[model samples]
Target: MTRLLFAALLAAIPLTAPAAPSDPYPSTYAPVPSPPVLIRNATVLTGSGERLDNADVLMQDGKIAAVGAGLTAPANAQVIDGTGRWVTPGIIDVHSHLGVYPSPGVNAHNDGNEMTSPTTPEVWAEHSITPQDPGFGTALAGGVTTMQLLPGSANLIGGRGVTVRNVYANTYQGMKFPGAPWGVKMACGENPKRVYGGKGSAPSTRMGNVAGYRADFIAAQDYMRAWDKYNAGDKKGDPPSRDLAKETLMGVLKGEILVHIHCYRADEMAIMLDLAKEFGFRISAFHHGVEAYKIADRLAAEGVCGALWADWWGFKMESLDGIQENIALVDRPEKGCAIVHSDSSEGIQRLNQEAAKVMGNARRVNIDIPPERAIRWLTQNPARALGIGDRTGTLAPGKMADVVLWNGTPFSVYAKAEKVFMDGALMYDRGDKSRQPVSDFMLGQEAAP
Candidate 1:
């Protein structure tokens, strides 16, 4: 009777979905896809190094379903006449501080850096992001579909950088780019040494900076070993005491997270590469690499990207060696991964023009660079650095429908983004103000010009 009762209870039990792993922070990005779209008769510059004249691009069910001439769209698809326009993959900025240090930059808005400690991987940039920052609309209007919001360089390890879509949303989680790998904001050279040196901290000098990194990474290695042993059932006890900072470092050592270091001089970057090798971690990119041209070949050989400014330099001692042709020279090397990143809000609105400046400088030096190749610096290269190359950064089948329709050749000085699409949704339309996003902060103010 007891066995029969147990069997009957088991048979009557209800089934439920298995819960997801306990990720302390989770993304809540719910993309709202638009109706199917068909763009025809446009000059298309694919970010992966291809240009098509009078081509057609079809977006269906939130993905690029077709790319070719003479493509047909569904009866309900919105066919946009792209004649006399330029179409390309959406712009992706690998470095930005939009939400962390948002607009109306007041004392209260300064939350980008955790200068209390030199090693602060425990903090997250997402936690400081203010979704209401009117900066999102400007970037969107500039055709920036995605960007990486990073912490300030006032510390040795600032925190984890967050990749977000440039969509105007209510929460940072909604703005986060889905499945993008987290980046650890680490600093080399003057920023960290100067900030801590004055405080009489241990890392008060250049050598001390290296020592600080080694100590933290060593602790991380020990922490990772302890957790591994526990998980393997070799050592039976309470799990290794959780250190939030070490947890993030362990992710870097395991290559699950990318390491983005703020560095300028070639020698410091080279030293950073050595430190990464010693700690068994890989640096994915070097931000503000003003002198990267000096060691461009080595960076290319290691598959590390140089996320550089076009010409802005010489404001600081470390950036003194910066050259106006930094971007072009770095890109001149074989297998070089060069990206034009705007660390300033004003610069973010003109990244296309920034790349154009680089091309013009290259021309003076007699270097041959085309529109298709230069567009890669703004799109595919940044996407690869943020680890989203497979999903977007190119207008091809099976990729996200993130594209821009420009009023003229994107490399031209007077070019402007006529329409910007994310997931096939018309996020920004110059002809229709209603199509552009109006954040809560801009409700009573003048519309974005």
Candidate 2:
């Protein structure tokens, strides 16, 4: 053939066919419809380190329309008198196990882990989530509009975690946060070593745990190379057999999925960061990191967040050195990304109080964190950790109108979320009994929340 004809034929032929799409279990979450609303004369914590007093927030089309002092309300808006009320972006919990380990706490409800293997990245937490969990309702009562449901840390790599809008739905996919990135659950130090050690597995020691992670990533690297070669049409063969675990790990290697590690010790966290460096992947956040205070500067420098508890510690050796001011210390460093996460079902319902504990302790130590700055721990910081920072965390114009109207300052023990809005739709109201969402599991119970 002529040179022009040969080039034309080459262009006409397709390069190669790709494997199946990465996300099989995708989000089906759609925001509830809402009318225009104007909450005026309120103290607003924008979740972006800005506090606006006597200001108004206008929402239209399920987004923040405006936020400022003396803003004119739309003619068709439902104006809420925010006298003496505090407004904030809806609380976002970076770590929660609500749906996976649903309430009623029976062995049958215990589905947060697939401990049969030390590395089971193939299994997703959403597959095991029970959308009827009553804890989600209680969390809404506490102003949690979004949360990440994670698997248990009983292995080296637990599985994929799913971020969900805290909305009532029959299916887990209905609650999945739209466009949220997937997170892989990893554990360092004790949990992995202990769980597998008792059963006499490969990862019986801390070093063994590290080895397990390295071995898996090495396999993931090879798997990634095979797929790359096939996709580039450099090799002439069908695509390599798909390994679900390696697919997830390869997503991490390719920077598609975020990495959330359940690590307590500062040393273990450092080691995990080094491991990520070795494998050329990123560590998004360290969940339940009790020793995060010891290396706050390092975490800040690396742009990794610490999703931590306010005071819970000392239940085990790895978490023994935890302090009441752990969260505060983590937030002390400049550019630090510190988040207050609720690992407990009960704790999820009191995330504001959890943040309050950190603020109170911080004040005692003279490291004052104002309401504007502290709100980020429960809102902006968690949103960023879950890779949804640009969407729902802040009260900026054009962002999702997920908001809470508290009867008092949220940090005060007496404060209560009087009204909660998700996507500008009123999801919960303390005054209206009908607006109080009760899960089907709690419908007939005498002590229903």
Candidate 3:
């Protein structure tokens, strides 16, 4: 649906206030605004299933001006020589934990999990985000232009995740991606059960998990109705006393916020889908969906994305059925929304390589996956999942000039992102000491961040 119609629909639902509330923490994402530039004579992967050998990509005022062969450089546009290099949209990691669980992992840094309860939608990942986390620069150096910082899976509802531009800043808001819809992070399987069950808590089993979600969503539905009556002018008194947690839940039900769940098993994922149907909400993506191959058609039918790792398997009981061919199998159908995600800090650095691995795995299974098509697992697909497809994720005209220059074929093991741009501004240059970013936390510990 168009954003206008969606907004009108959102307005129809009873909200605590406006759907787009003044961000208590607003983004400080001011573009440095690079000059118009012409990147010529490169192998361009446009993220639209088209590869152009010896192409020219033009950028003007931080947006793609044009992309094709023999594109003329506008007046005084800086010309970038891209001979023998590969240019594509900067890689986007849909799942990440760069800030909340920053580098130099320590018990003191364990802020990802809010284990006080199975549901804590009142919390937000941005509040706990430490912008000085060196991991941001590391991922940026690896060509990650955008990512979402999600809450860990310890809770049945682990607060909200923040989508961000991979920029180094002093505050989390400074790094927040502009106009990105927030997502609620929820989980279905072992994590919630184990954590609460270990404490002799309520959700000691999978059944308990389902019951908890139902109870909470039911409460939210009732809450919405109450305010809805008031907003409709039939009710008497002022608005119902605000419930931060319930407010977020209502947002999901009203389609104001996206639902990104961490689910592994196919049975549990199906159950989650049923729960979403029951509550009248949408499940955007199933993070770490190891067994999604079993229900790939169901997910595609529902237009839900499966944000999964390329080959992560067997670390836990829920993940035992995972296969390296999981992504390949899910991507087999033309309708499937197969995504390559990294739940780990280390893995986020090379999401391109991870997608490449999935492409290779698919080819080995006699499935011919072309580079242009496979690159979507790293770019436009993730953007579409994140609800930012119109702005970034491709080299299309008027999209953000978030481009990456690879030293070799991006799918090859020997490849490296020699240059990375965000909004046409040079952010990371492997050959230049001046352009690389270094976070405050790593000022003394590490030299090149």
Question: What residue pairs clash in candidate 2, if any at all?
Answer: none
Residue-level lDDT tens digits of model 2 in 137-213: 88999999999999999989999999998887768877888778899999988888888899987789999999999
In candidate 2, how many Å is residue 209 off?
A: 0.3
Total clashes in model 1, counting residue pairs 3 or more apart in sequence or in different chains: 0
lDDT agreement with native, every candidate: 0.87, 0.89, 0.86
Give each prediction's root-mean-square deviation over alpha carbons: 8.5, 10.1, 7.0
Alpha-carbon runs more than 4 Å astray in model 3: 1-22, 234-236, 446-449
Tally clashes: model 3: 0
Task: Give the lDDT of residue 64 in candidate 3.
Answer: 90
TM-score, one value per model = 0.94, 0.94, 0.94
Off-target runs (Cα >4 Å) in candidate 1 are 1-22, 332-334, 447-449
Local accuracy of candidate 3 as per-residue lDDT tens digits, 386-436: 899999988999999999999978888788999998888787889886677
